[model samples]
Target chain A: MASRILGRLPLDEDRLAQDMARLAQAPAPQEPYEVFTIGRWVNLNLWNASGDDGDGFFNGHRQVAGRPTRLLGGVPYIGELLTTWFNTELLTMVRARNVVEWSIVPHRDFLESGPAEDFFRVLVFLEDNEHALNSDEDMVFHMRKGEVWFLDSAQIHAGVNISSRSRWSLCLDFKAGAGFSPGDVFARAGDYDPAIRPALVERAPAPADLPDRLRALSAVVSRHNIKDIAFLLGKVHFTEEVPIGASWDWLVEITRASGDPALLDLAERARRFFVHSREVYEEFSFVPA
Target chain B: MASRILGRLPLDEDRLAQDMARLAQAPAPQEPYEVFTIGRWVNLNLWNASGDDGDGFFNGHRQVAGRPTRLLGGVPYIGELLTTWFNTELLTMVRARNVVEWSIVPHRDFLESGPAEDFFRVLVFLEDNEHALNSDEDMVFHMRKGEVWFLDSAQIHAGVNISSRSRWSLCLDFKAGAGFSPGDVFARAGDYDPAIRPALVERAPAPADLPDRLRALSAVVSRHNIKDIAFLLGKVHFTEEVPIGASWDWLVEITRASGDPALLDLAERARRFFVHSREVYEEFSFVPA
Candidate 1:
């Protein structure tokens, strides 16, 4: 009985369902949030928030020190019966995250040099919207979601919005968190080979608890060079170093999205009970859920 | 909405839990009949007396001819809670039929074959003595279950079991069913050429309810010198056929496994409304589940 708790967000099923139906009938999305339907995407829940809104919700990503940043919100969204059903039926709790209006690419008024670079441009549909994300592959699906085509962020990919539909999805990402791949930031930063090191498989059993694809991915990420700091992370990375803007709420969100709240909490409790790693929630750079 | 009853069996949740735990600890089976375990089996609710039981279930193949067979009682066994959780979480209702007892080689006697024709043996472990299975092979994953290699059925290609410990998993033998490719049956029959024939996607819109894989297969099945009987399957083959077996009761078991009686009743109504096509039911074979 090893288990831990992470974050929780309320889900709104009706709104999600309505959005799903609307998006279903809407045409394929395009360059400037044009079309709204076609392809496969169904609603699971809804949350209260929008782009740059103050109700503690976010819609867009920001660039800091040449790095992209995510806004804060407890990762869990409300009204989704699937995760609960999964836990109750399977007896295995999962980590998960929440999404509100985070767009893959900002629907600029057409003349903004097609959005920024260093950022991704996906080429496929994001749940509801049927536009090819210009290499902007942001979503990841777990076993509970048919387990195919779900994108893992660490992988090199991008997308572009070729359709004209509002691009919105309550995206959640999940994975096990442990001091495995994200080695002790305390360890000299350049000491470990960013690409060839092993994951926290022993330290962060999170990958162990996750689905095979993610688990295999953890291995792949471990072997691949970090390339850039913002893109590479491990459960242990947070244990060693402090990064600006990382929030406990963000940790909760990532874990929540992993579909296992229990493990997220476990990471926190592990630091508290064993490592005496007493740091505020928002201090750590990242938490692998 | 479109739905159907899977089946009702002696669904003892507590007993099932206890059985799962006990079986996880059980050793390799000594005999083939031990794998069958009785008291548990294919739930009649999901399927009806119809067609042949393709080797999808792996343990054996049952293709009844002339007369319809009696549908049995039970729930779809996914080898263990681990698998059940993965499947219930990933594919929602996708099943994994682990190899256990079958016509060619019974349980522990697997060693007699010296080596299996394929690497991924459809062997099952005792989870409180329940059965488990897996069929589709869209991707392959390599990882761990408490430090051991974990197998993913999504990727096609066979595997060799070179472990000293028992590997209990749902055996899923993917024989392209009544839908497409004419399967080993047709290829072996030499009635069609695998390379010459265009794949299923090249065909027309298949039965709406069937998964794309199965729909393609349905197209293949129809191409058989068996078109008349195949189309009589109408939407039935697509809707009525369960991953493991095809029977009216299979409908019931799926509903029951959902643990929602309302859904259960939904399936039951379908059974009554569209009485079993006796001629067709008689033709269906019981696959290993």
Candidate 2:
């Protein structure tokens, strides 16, 4: 299942309040910070460990599977600062494995109306909302001070001023390290079917015994070995004459890896005698570039 | 509005077919090509253009976008070939000031089960599909040996091919230069609005003259000049102090820019200055990065 690790940090509310005041009025200068600021607003988002992309709303617009820049356009106290704290804290809590080394979801995706499954989302607060937590879903908790609230992202949520007074807290979203499996986060990767036309039946048949070349091909397929599958396709000889598709299938059946795209692509590319008996000049089985 | 520019090259079916073959067989070239033999083939979807943002789908997907090996996976065909063909065939043939340059439309978001305006679309290729066109959405005109057809991606559409024999053509989702407004294309840029609980009241005296600062802000706003409006906010004195939830409205009212994010963002940030009095310091405003 998709898993997430959580933790917290001691916040300096006094410093935060003072920082907020700086945004309100120009105070006497003490010294510049590591990053000079009108305030302590740091852009927090799903960036690589390298810390390349600067924070803003535009980065979060188009959320695809892996490259999800989930948050955007928010002040630091609520997001980036919290995440930075979490990352630093995570470093100390557990020394290694399945550890999330970065990012955090302070706010989530939710709209007033939509389908049940899409009604609630873990919305990244920034551009494109790059990736959205599924609606009709919830994470274990949303971060809160004193005690932590395993926020079920399923709730329609946004950052609101719970108090006229601003609150300061740490937040984090960590990518699982070596001990973690991304696909495991969801379910194990599905048993995806290849582009086999299930409706179409292969008509090729075989004798109980195998021929030498056919045997060699047979050895190639069973192991899910792509290169060997291609090798056998060019080398094997069929006892029963079969059509193009069936001939291909029979080769794969004997080798065990026949229909896999990896093998098929190789056969189509490798400079060898095509099943059609012609020495294809165009190994890719197509015309010139 | 979104924009683009598309050009044409005489079908070097022979050359393309050849190059495609080489690339397909070359152990996953990293540039623009995706797959050559697999039934489902595609091109590039470079999620890292904005850099690696793990927050959403827009980041990167080795699956759909193709992984870069020899730098050929998801790369556009950038060479004398595309350049010469584009400039000579399309751009030169037709000239215009601004065309659809780059655009993306959230097709999945706008899909409608039933045919709808500004909704999900399905491109159903009916009986004798050969009579019209073969491109997924009539991206451009499709002219085969005998017939010609115009492409239309106005709604949710999917293709159904009942032809007995296998037909050959390329199927891909790419942004090409176009004479049409990019906004009209699939996945073109669109917009969203934030919830605003605005409190607006015409003053009791029915003031004949708005203050000079307000008038100046209004002028800058009229020109859609948010930066200048921001500049004004840095130097304005309001006769009526801004009310809560109305900070954004104040900035817009005081400026000439229209009600847009750039303007609203300025107002939202200004709210961070919600102190009872401006006693501590002066000249603190939201300085955009």
- Each candidate's TM vs. the true structure? 0.17, 0.20
Give the candidate number with the greatest TM-score: 2
Q: Candidate 2 regions off by >4 Å?
A: A1-50, A54-73, A80-289, B1-149, B152-289
Worst 10 residues of 2 chain A by lDDT: A93-102
- Accuracy of chain B in candidate 1 (TM-score): 0.21
Q: For residues B1-289, what per-residue lDDT tens digits would candidate 1 score against the true structure?
A: 0011111122345655554444333221112121212111221111212322211122212322111111111222322332322222111111222222111100121222222222222222232221112221221122112111122222212221111122333322222223322122211233222232111111123344443322222211111111111112221222122321232344455445546566556445534433322221121111111
Candidate 1 lDDT for residue B240: 27
Candidate 2, residues B1-289: lDDT per residue as tens digits? 1111121224444554554454333221111110001111222222222222111121111112212122223223322232332212111111000000001110111111212232211111111223122222212112232111112333211121112222232211222233433222222123111122211222123133434324433322421123223322321111122222232355645532434565455554443332211222222233321
Instruction: Encode model 1's per-residue lDDT on A113-183: one tens digit a residue.
Output: 12222222111122443222322112212111111122333332222222323344433321213322321
The true-versus-predicted C-alpha distance at residue A33 of model 1, in Å, is: 48
